[model samples]
Target chain A: MGQEILAIIVIMTAVTYGARVLPFLLFRNKRISGVLKSFIELVPVALLAALVIPELILTPTNEFTFINPFLLTGICTFIFARRVSNLFLVVLFGMVVYWGFDKII
Target chain B: MRVKGFIYGLRQSVTIGIGYAPVALTFGILSLKSGLNILETGLMSMLVFAGASQFITIQLIGQGATIWVIGITTLIVNLRHILMSFSMIRFFPGISLGKLSLLAQGITDETFVLNSKLLEEIPTPEERSNVALGVNIGAFVSWVFFSFLGAWFGNRLNINFSGFDFALLALFIVLTIGTVNRQNITTYIIAGLLAVIFKIIIPGKIYLLLSVALAAAIGAFLQQKQLKQNKCQGENS
Candidate 1:
């Protein structure tokens, strides 16, 4: 890689690492308030929603749902994953459903 | 009895490693198609280590976007790390700043989930940190390795990666379902709808942060309301 690409990677790493480390550093020894804890507790679900909803449905950019059987794909994946016990198997089932739906549509 | 936290962490994180493989392979293939060399692809996986941000970065780079665009956008997209790390503060008490920083580098979504769930199970701080390091290293190696594999053989391979995209959605579904106990179904429903609405309206990575903030506020509000009601019942009694 050239200096430019290396520089971009470095900058990306720096900012990401800085963000990840900031909370642990700044909030050291401080009491986390109840409201703050509640909010933080809620974050994973909210962020996951923020990510999945957009991508699964009408995404802003280059959405595969355009040509693909978008809703059916999601439904089938959801149902198919439920029957599987293993995480890997669930994901594999979802992918299979995705491909099957894509072909049908 | 033998206690091996690092080995335990590795065993626990093997699932995470497997989960990351398909997506990371797709990332490698995408990066290569986006005109990145094998070195650049591997560097992005090793350094950035963020799934969504790296994907967006590749798309932007392919579009001849500026460094500022990629940098700022990826940083914003990954802002939720602040919340995740904040939640982990009480779990990692009394650790040195340097070690904390090192552990923070290894925290991905999978590791964060694993560490939070297993923190209470592992009593000793030393063991806990060791396991966390194991999870981090395991996932990191898996990601970088698949990325290199994809980049090296991208053009020579004839694979349809469209199905691979479902892995991301499947991950979110599993995570969300894991949280869908009787306690907070309403929160999930409202937050989920709000996220969709927020995305449709805003149509950028910033919407992700906005939606999370708003939905988390809903949770906070519900908690406050319940607390106030408890106080009222106490006063009446």
Candidate 2:
């Protein structure tokens, strides 16, 4: 049992590190072209949107819902964040909103 | 100056470090309940150091999944890191592979978003690199420490983390709002829509990479065309 768990750990560490380090190794010290540079610049916005939206809308069971607490927290946080740039306050407001919504929903 | 940059990086990571606590604690508790001993749980957090992938791994282990199944799932889930690491290369050019590789290990989603935004505002490459290092190490310590703490107290504490999960999501929301601007607004919206569409159509987590690639491609194409049009109008006038 211990050996099997060890194998799993080793495999996960290898693949996770590989996924992260591959780009750095491949493109090290190379001059980035305009197209690739634009793509790179644009990726964070695109990827963050991709990461956030689905999680907001989908439940753990993969059911789509509009009335999610997390979704409400997100909208509230977005509005609050526009007025206030403090990360801690924005996140705290989000948590309060989420807790409130979770109670009702 | 380097120490200042590192200190600044650590300060920037406070929100992320705070956000990581409950989640990492939850991860540790879950791992303990899933039959992993304290040492194993600590090892997983210390070695893997990726959040979502680690959670997925613990879940898979609970379900009696095969080793290969878990490995593949982790690889797919973490493949997004490749895009992040690639994006970061533009900032740290001419740095050695050894230093860059160390930075690469710290490229989780939270730090990636934070550093990408902060790195651009800072002028010097050296300071940028130092800041990135500080953010990475700070977040790393929080995650590993909290995970081990959770495992250590898993059996003793019965705390519920119901609303705490929203903290990380809130950070993402705030950062995402910061990234939106006139230039990338279209891409951002399209990416969100495509993510929802593809999440339904596709299996596993590959939907993330696909939607990002397609949306960013469209954005880059539009941007280049606009640039060319401006140049042509200048020449004509």
Candidate 3:
């Protein structure tokens, strides 16, 4: 079972690394348009939002809950993150608030 | 010059490495709890290195999904990195193909942001690549070490922590706030609203990719319009 899992990890890693590395190799000498370049630049931020919001909003039961502790903490974190540039403090604040809320309620 | 660039890169990498340790450690523990052995858990982190995708993959695997299903799901979840890699191509024009490929493998969200910002400060291609290499190696080392730490200490420690999952979400919120500027705020708002709306309507994992595409399209359209308007104003003036 462990070896099988290891095999799976190896396969997935190669696949993912290939996916990331192939593009750079293929497009190394090619010149892309400015418009396309701008569009690609927007991908990371959009992808980050997509990755984050759903997990925060959705309950384990699969129902959408807006007033959840996670969301509240996220909003607080977002606000603090804006005001504070330090990653450690921002994460610390969010974790404390989140843990406090979970314990209290 | 190469030595200096390498040193600077190493320093930046160490900072990112420290940042990634806790999260990867959590992933390691979660994988162990999911019935994976220490070796399997560490290999997963070392190989995949994608934080959210690995978490989701482990959760699915723990639920008894087949390997094929788990692999495909992880691939789809990590598809956004392909787009990220494309955006990063311009930064590595002068580097050798081998180094560029190695650097591309390390392009996580944190590394991408750090390298992009570093490029602004260090206009020289070598310096920028150094920062990218530094951040990547730092993150890679931290990920592997903490994951092992989590796996090794998994059985001994009973950490009954809840709400710690919000760390990633909180980090994203902080990053989003940091990245938004006056010109991009409108794009950000539109994307945020559209993502929430799609999350309501869409059924499953499709929402993740759909919202991203929609948001990027919206942002690109707005940016192009603004650029054209500026060009027109310049012509008229």
Better of 2 and 3 by lDDT: 2
* Candidate DockQ scores, in order: 0.53, 0.71, 0.50
* Strongest candidate by TM-score: 2
Candidate 3 lDDT over B129-180, as tens digits, reads 8777877877788888888888889557565766455665666666676566
lDDT of 1 at B29: 93
Candidate 3 — which residues are off by over 4 angstroms? Answer: A1-3, A55-67, A78-83, B1-23, B33-35, B59-66, B160-164, B197-206
Measured with C-alpha atoms, the lDDT of residue A68 in candidate 2 is: 83
Stretches of candidate 1 exceeding 4 Å from the true structure: A59-85, B1-3, B33-35, B113-128, B161-163
Better of 2 and 3 by TM-score: 2
Q: Please give the TM-score for the first chain of candidate 2.
A: 0.89
lDDT by residue (B1-237, candidate 2, tens digit) is 989999999988888898899889889999989889889988999889998888888889999999999999998888888888999998997677888889988998889988888898998878899999999999999999999999999567766646676777888888887888999999999999999988888877778888988898888888888888999999999
What is the per-candidate TM-score for chain B? 0.84, 0.93, 0.83
Interface RMSD of each: 2.6, 1.6, 2.8
For candidate 2 chain B, which ten residues in a row score worst on lDDT?
A: B154-163
For residues A6-104, write the lDDT of model 2, one tens digit per residue.
899999999999988999989888898766777889998998898899988988667798888888888888889999998878878787788889889
Superposed on all Cα atoms, the candidates' RMSDs to the truth, in angstroms, are: 3.4, 1.8, 3.4
List candidate 2 stretches off by more than 4 Å: none
Candidate 3 residue lDDT tens string, A1-105:
576677678767876787678778788857776567667667667766665666678776557788878888888888787778877677778878988777765
Which candidate comes out best when scored by DockQ? 2
Chain A TM-score per candidate? Answer: 0.77, 0.89, 0.82
